[model samples]
Target: MAPAQSGAVLGLSLSLLLGACRIQAVKLSSDNLTPTVMEFQSVELSCIIKSTKTPNPRIEWKKIRNDETTYVYFDDEVTGAFENRADLLNRASLMIKNATRTDTATYRCEVVAKSDEKTIDEIKIVLTVQVKPVVPRCIVPKSVPVGSAAALYCDEKEGFPNPTYRWYWNSEPLPEESKSHPKYVNSSFKVDPKSGTLTFTSVVKADTGVYYCIATNQAGSAKCEGHSMEVYDLNIAAIVGGVIVVVLILALIIMGLCFAYRKGYFANSKPSTSYKTPAKPDCVNYLRTEDEGDFRHKSSFVI
Candidate 1:
């Protein structure tokens, strides 16, 4: 009885393993295998499924950008931003018309078959759209004072494969050597090829000229309109000297006033001692009698 029970248990385990190893309902693949194209061109990103149990499989396409997945093709129709420029046919193959750089992204082709329990097959394909360089915008200062820093800026934002830069003066390429030209003879000028920044530590009159910049990539090249740069003498030393002279004059005036105060030149005057007054001696009074009325004499005091 123990042997029979053990055999039944082994049979149940075998059934479970077989169920887990069932064959996939469908196999999905892309026709292009690896797709790459230039900007503003048509391309096909086709997906096909084989050996599907369901006659009609639900098809979908999704794109991934910046770690976010968004739907592009579904419900037997192209929807979202691609509705007007894309079409889905032949088991949900994607056909894009007039594709632009914005279309560059990773696309996933998904197919679902409904049988005894739904099954899905999906594959990912990356698309790249190359773009050429357009005319870059460049700015050169109208005027730069001598013995001061100067900067020239250039920008080219629309390009694929990235863009490189070159600068020109008077319609000629910039000199390779820093001191090779008269304008930059002082070794104060510098350039950055990647960021397109040209600088001068101490600009000079010789540095004045028409300047332009060019941007290039694998696809194409472009140039900006020529701009003018003028460098003039600032006479900054003379101005600074004048300021110092004025400050010294004011200092001298203040020092003179302080010295005068310390020497008592601003002290108060001393009191006077020149004059005196006389003193009175004494006062005497006499009473008048009736018999003496005829005599009628007034007494006076003398000092």
Candidate 2:
């Protein structure tokens, strides 16, 4: 080969090696593991790029939850959903303020180098947001007929680690089986601890009182409002008695009417309704009799 051609080939090889060395020189690394944080607090996740092939490596952050991986930071700005509470530092870490349970997810920090046409590095951080259970909402029957089914419902939606629920009767925790409460041997009911439901297959008269539901989690516990239940038995015998009394009153009225009708007690007392007298005039006028002819009566004295 010619000396000039050989020199050109060698220079090209050196340049390729130098470029490879520059890319290898970029040191991007971070060691962040699963971290737990309380609600309404600040947390920082690190993804340090010790060195980069390019002087200006762009930083990006994304969140992974369930089936979705969405951008948290892009183009040197936090996205609209997490704008106020999220911040980036030194192109390697993310700071979040007032974290909530909804913010609990896996965060990924990705660094990209435009000059090297490569992804510098990426690190994953798991974040868990611990939150206490909020007050539970409950519903129960105010009253139910005896021998009927009754159900009480309770739920606590605002909590982390999914709260476990329980039921209480008269301020005492009610068990699934009546045998747990020795004093209430006749009680027949079932309670689900997770769902906080109290159910009775056949409510009895004794099952009439206020009840409560409680929700608990790793952070704390909470309770729902009081719910009162009343079971009553229908008194058919009293209703029958009332019907009999009403029938007797109606029969007595009917008997009195029949007897009065048979005895002509409704007849009119007088027959003068069809016989009316003629009207008489207050003054009577009569013509002078002709027995005294030409009898004139006049005032004679002029004085």
Candidate 3:
């Protein structure tokens, strides 16, 4: 073979070798970029090695939540809250045996292969853990007067992705617009699903019924027990009669007090004069001696 041709062939071989090295550089990928699972259930975050030259590459996983980052896997071991419940699958993927709501966040998987031309590569995965809602706390008034205002409330705190509220009256769901539904046309109330408040602008006799509330989210729903609310009409005649009776009684009391004052029954009595006797002398005696020719003698003695 010619020397020039041999040199050209060697140069071509070197170029192909470099191209191969570039093609085999460390690379990472994921089968599922986003995975969702129910709370307490198991889930796997797929991190696959697309291409790499290193036989034993360094793998690490970090979780990003609320703009904060923390390690889930480091130093070839699971760490933090996932220490006991998580493990690596295929030496690259992460498997959580018991997922929780707090585990829902963005996760990053990184691989470092020093032997490869490109030393590092990474991929991101999003996890969502859905939590079922517990029974909600509900407050309903026991009684309300007709034409008066009333309010009912419901709330739940355990669900993931904050829950919305729904109210039921006598086992029937209440619509958001009362006038839109014939069954609820008699009620003058408003429902606030986000705040879980049911406000009655003006209650009537038809508003009396058994009420219950339900809280719902993407995971599940829960409801409180039913409570009865009574609405009664105001007895105007009876109330007026009672007021008149009270006023008459008060007036009679005032008249009795005035009559007692005018008759001198409550007047102050006249004060009587007081007399005091004079005190006698302590020890003094007077004696008359006729034998001494009308002589008077005075003596002082202690008794």
Candidate 4:
């Protein structure tokens, strides 16, 4: 009786263990694996999975770069190649650090049970990681004064691959070295190759005009709307200069008139003394007097 009882207990334990080992069904649901677009240094890719069966089933994460296949994430024990670069999130999620264009590929998640049959389930996702400079709308200063610096800014928040940024003024593209315009030609105007942020140290009056920014990538291209740039105090200066010139001209005209009047008045009015040798006849010079008319001699100075 004792032996039979012992045998019955062993059989029950074996039955329980076998029942626990057997897998009823394997259900798999993947967290969204949408591709992300970001700058070169700012990319993270991860996937979540929910398994209804055993929590510790053998799992594998694969990458399909170009036409090649590579494993980036695995079960609890990640491969040495992806040791610090990959992480497992919670019960069923995989994360890749610092994702790049090279990391873009099709990934797979697989799970297999420990049963004798070794049934397996799997799911695949495509991830495209983008890495490039950020480029955004161009904003120009209200006014750029001569001998002063003016700034042209491009927002660096929107783009994919990211993008390469270039600025244009009045439809003409300015190179990195042209310094004809002093205020807007400083080194600060150049944007960082990796990032698309620019600054103008000083702006000149010639810098006033319209400006635009262009963003491009291998995938696509775009351009920002043109913004206006104006010069300061130009109208006031022109008005003042014109007024000064007109006043000077009027003063010269008045001085010339006064000088001509003085010359005419200062001229001598004396008669010629050389002609006194010839005398006129008295009879011809006598005035006619008739019917009690009297002649009055009025002295008229002709000197």
Model 2 per-residue lDDT tens digits across residues 189-254: 888877777888888888898998888988789988888898888889999999999999999999
Alpha-carbon deviation at 17 in model 4, angstroms: 22
Would you list the C-alpha lDDT of every candidate in the order shown?
Answer: 0.82, 0.82, 0.91, 0.63
**Highest lDDT model number:** 3
- The regions of model 3 sitting more than 4 angstroms off are 1-24, 269-303
Structural RMSD, model 2: 10.6
The residue pairs that clash in candidate 3, if any, are none
lDDT, candidate 2, equals: 0.82
Q: RMSD, each candidate, Å?
A: 13.9, 10.6, 6.6, 22.4
**True lDDT of residue 158, candidate 1:** 95
User: What is the overall TM-score of model 2 with all chains considered together?
Assistant: 0.61
**TM-score, structure 1 vs. true:** 0.59
Worst 10 residues of 1 by lDDT: 294-303
Give Cα distance to truth, residue 103, candidate 4, Å.
1.5
* Candidate 3 lDDT over residue span 1-303, tens digit each: 999999999999999997797767988888899998999999999999888879899999999999999999999989998999999998799999999899999999999998887899999999999999899999999999999999999989999888999999999999876888887788798889988999999999999999999999999999999999999989999999999999999999999999999999999999998888966454544455766654333354434
Worst 10 residues of 3 by lDDT: 294-303
Name the candidate that leads on TM-score: 3
For candidate 1, the per-residue lDDT at 81 reads 87
